[model samples]
Target: MNPFDRRPTYFFGVYHWRERLRRIGASLSLFGAAVVVGRRGGRLRRLLAALVGVTALVRAGTTARRLLSPVPWALDRPKYDALASLLPLGDVDRALDVGCGSGRSLVGLAPHLPSSTHVVGLDVFDDRVILGNGPQLARRNGARAGIDVSPAAGDASRLPFSDDAFDVVTACRVAHDVPETRRDALFDELRRVCAEDGTVGLLELPITPEGVSDHEAYWRRCLGDAGLSVERVATVERPGFSDEPYVAIAATPTA
Candidate 1:
């Protein structure tokens, strides 16, 4: 694969240098305030300042790392690869990626499916959260990967597709972001669009401290409430970011 070919101009190819610099400056100011509080304030004030300082430092460090190296950004490839492998794609004819940012997951899963398979990615692009033109960037990324993907602007909670429209449906790191009250609606939409025998693959960050405990029950309940049955669950460990573990859940519509 040509590193320069088909790459999205805004997604990974362009760095948000100005935004990162602003964050760095803010973090430095917070650190300076922490030092002043520690020297002249009460014990409680010092403790609060210390907490804020630590958070600021961590944010600055992560932002700096992202700016200095491409490895952190490239990690999405392996993450999507793992997600695609966990889903049943051998005989898939039509697939959809909900909340597909820059079409990375769709492109990554394309190679695993039959050449004739049709893949579509839907996302409600918010300029504040999503960098650049999402649908266009997704198309460019798909072209670079030699996959033909249809990218569209849509919401997960209210998918525009008719019932039983896709053979495989997947979402990466999107469910938890939905408000607690609306999460069920999102899964309900996923179940509605998925064919009876089709699989719904969800990749999410661990919600529990140990990374595997009660989270299983929580997801099972969520899927069940949405009229889906959990088939399998697996935890994927990201190479560079060990503290953040990804959980992939495969579910099927209930009878």
Candidate 2:
């Protein structure tokens, strides 16, 4: 069996359904306008209506297709598996995944750890983007995968764990979501919870010019300011998304 062939069973979160419905509604509205305008409008008006309707229909179809297949989200199994591989799982007794959405990264990392290793996942599960009981789904998915993962609702900037509580800490595509005012706090929490020599793995998409200006430089500064030494940085690209690439950074505490 292929290691990355597994399909994600819990992809239809609240946000997913919401987006699907929004698209479908927009498509229907556009089609209705096209029908009404075509009945009594001029040639130019009919052409414009048809174009708008067709465009909306296409967008609706595309959104539906994205939800159906795990391509952009769950299908990137290799990336999660790779991030997990970067950790020292055998030596890690306690692992923490910050912003662990649906336990995808945890499920990928758990198989590599020792049976005695305790894995915990933390997320606010605020449903700001993807709606659903994130923590609940994560727990269910972890159990089905035969991995013992404890999922809980919590803030990333203010971690509940004590200092030096975890041997391994990972945050995938979470840094960008943190507000600028609390970004430093989030990194500090990561450093506080990580052991003296523990590893910190981060996987994030390149900061777009419309977003953060410079992706690499921004992360380097963010990590460096947090007193973490970036040991390595690698890029992962998935075609059809964008020309820009995704970046994964591995760092260790300097203090």
The per-model lDDT (C-alpha) reads 0.77, 0.77
TM-score list, all predictions: 0.74, 0.82
Query: What lDDT tens digits, residue by residue, belong to model 2 across residues 33-94?
Result: 88788778899988888887788778778877765544323535666666666667787789
The list of candidate 1 runs beyond 4 A from truth reads: 1-21, 25-62, 66-73, 208-213, 240-244
Clash counts for all predictions: 0, 1
Report the error of model 1 at residue 180, Å.
1.0
Question: Which candidate ranks first by TM-score, i.e. highest?
Answer: 2
- The stretch of ten residues in a row with the least summed lDDT in candidate 2 is 67-76
Off by over 4 Å in 2: 1-20, 40-48, 68-73, 131-133, 208-214, 241-243
Residue 70, model 2: Cα distance from true site in angstroms: 4.9
